[model samples]
Target: MKTWKVLWRVMMVLCVCVFTVNIVSYPQPEVTEVLSKYGSRSEEVRQIQTKLKQWGYYFGSVDGIYGTQTQDAVIKFQKKNGLRVDGIAGPETLAAIGISSSSGSSGSTGASTSDVNLLARTISAEARGEPYSGQVAVGAVILNRVEHPSFPDTIAGVIYQPGAFSCLNDGQFDQPVAESAYRAARDALNGVDPSGGAIYYYNPVTATNEWIRSRPIINTIGQHVFCM
Candidate 1:
């Protein structure tokens, strides 16, 4: 009887292990279409912002960069339109937004190219060697500041604000932007707030500002501690 009980317990343990593995291995929904966020600077994203703004959804500038305000607008639109509330401009979401793939909406470069370049430069300067998500986190912080009362209202204004970022003061912002930086900027603009809506971030090892450190921490990504 003891031997039988031992075998049954082992079987139960094995079953639990298998179940856990299956849960962990479950596939998540793949984001196959354009994922616009807070710092994304593309024509397609601009169109979404413009349409959403016209329809009383978005209220921010239509500068082709996705930001927190744009994300909120997209979510409201998606929720109201009975579409998936993921806030991503996937095929179905775009179609519902009155933008056909064949229409090639928001594709024109126009003058928004400068905004993209500027954001890419900022990301590259601040998070050159960080992980891709970390770079996005850096961009998200910039966008968060734009929406915050204490910070500037625009991307350029936030980035160029006096004594805002050390990279700008140290001439790191002048370096050529990296391709990864552009991707990271787009990710952040696409509403990927990996820092959980953080408005500030700093490396714990290098951060000397006691005030910044005193703020409530949100999360740590790469080498930076994101703060609310």
Candidate 2:
């Protein structure tokens, strides 16, 4: 009996250590993320986190911050070759990011005439060939901007605002839609609002526009900083 107790204790200790490693390696998500992921907070959010943990995609306390672990896991997957990581997701992320949650709708609708395609066209106009989740995020930022009263009321107007997106200024927005922009656009329109409600976004890492520094930041994601 004593040997069995010792064995049991050893197993418990090992389990604890493994759990600790996972928690430490991954940051927890913020509370709002939890609410958004499940489309409404309830016992189901906990269940989603539990599943995320099981899949090595969530590391935060099950208390539901949707914290760093979730973000890092999301970032890690996005960083991998050929993966799009917007942190928040739709079908693409659901299928590829190794995490899944219902967005309160029946997911996206009509693959042929879907918002995803509309989003794709919009993204093509704005970001064109920009790579990966950053481009997707940029598209989301523009949409977020459109939602704000301070910006234009439509995607075309905001993007076409003089010197807003250089691509638009240089006539790229009028060009044929590219595949990457389509993916990013689709992801954004699918309810993956990664910018939350940011009204402006810029790449400080590459930007030479001095005026962008004046805007107050609402959040940062990938390589872009979003502001009000």
**Number of the predicted model whose TM-score against the real structure is largest:** 1
Q: lDDT scores for all predictions? A: 0.76, 0.58
Compared with the true structure, the alpha-carbon lDDT of candidate 1 equals 0.76
The estimated TM-scores of all candidates read 0.52, 0.42
Compose the digit string of candidate 2's lDDT tens values, residues 1-228: 999999999999999999999989897865654322423344544544555565455677776444556556555544431345555444444433222344422344423232344445556765544456666777777777767777755453454355566763566645677877766776776656666666677778888878887889877766678776
- In terms of lDDT, the best-performing candidate is 1
Model 2 misplaced stretches (Cα beyond 4 Å): 1-122, 125-131, 174-176
Lowest-scoring 10 consecutive residues by lDDT in candidate 2? 97-106
**C-alpha lDDT (0 to 100) for residue 118 of candidate 2:** 40
Per residue, candidate 1 scores C-alpha lDDT tens digits across 1-228 of 999999999999999999999999999989654556657789989888877776667788988887788888888866654457886776556655645443222223221333455677889999989988899999999888978999756565677566788886687876777899987777777677888999999999999999999999999988999998
